[model samples]
Target: SLLVTSGPPDSSLQIWQVVPEDSADVIKCVSAIATENCTGQPWAKIATISARAPWVLHGSRLNSVRITDVESRKNVYVAGSSSSQELSGLAFLDCDTLLLCCAEGQLCLADVRHPQILLEAAPIPS
Candidate 1:
């Protein structure tokens, strides 16, 4: 868990929590700090949990990634899936539903509360 990071050298750092072993695909929480001028500042939860190659698509490279939380639905948004060997190929799907990574490869990003386990990384098709 990354909490309260300081400057370039980051003098002030604290240990938040330890990730367990059973967690296959665990999304960690991130908090943001206020500016120096703010006397009484509060840390806000910035983004939901995401991982390496979080946004995946067939025959594409991901250009951008964004997350949205609304009353109707909460989702993880991604964009720029136009390259195969590129990490910026694929864009975000409509919502956080079961993703079709390849012809025989199935990548399902389960719900935030009940996340699906990612056993392996699908090889980007040529």
Candidate 2:
């Protein structure tokens, strides 16, 4: 299974499943999460991650990442970002470790199991 997040001025998160069919790889969208509610409220940023089972992390426009459970459809963890930091990319380094890049030139290493930032790096100004 794979999770993807995308938007252009607005964002959405989706989960996909990779299957083998006819000796080829086929990707299918299994779940589409609403980044906005009925009132048109934004829920996530343009970056997302599929951590361990049931734990899906979504970036928000408000400089924070929200961790939600696919099974319960509830929030589990919320990782806060700086005011100048907006999530630009997300990658899983391991089962519990994640790498997050920000638009403001910050690289953050976070733990998926808990709401803690293990490491962070910011680009030096020229």
Report the number of the highest-lDDT candidate.
2
TM accuracy, model 2: 0.57
Clashes of each: 17, 1
lDDT digits (tens) for residues 1-126 of candidate 2: 565544443455666778889989999878665553223444454434444555666664324566667666677765655444555666666766667776666787777566655477767889
lDDT by residue (tens digit), candidate 1, 1-126? 433232222221222334566856454434322212122222111222234322222212122122333221224343223322222122233434323232244342323223333223556688
Indicate the residue-level lDDT of 68 in model 1: 35
**Lowest summed lDDT over 10 consecutive residues: which window, candidate 1?**
56-65
Error of 2 at 3 (Å): 5.9
Query: Which parts of model 2 have CA positions greater than 4 angstroms off?
Result: 1-5, 8-10, 15-31, 36-51, 60-62, 82-84, 116-118
The local distance difference test score of model 1 is 0.29
Q: What's the true lDDT of residue 18 in model 1?
A: 43
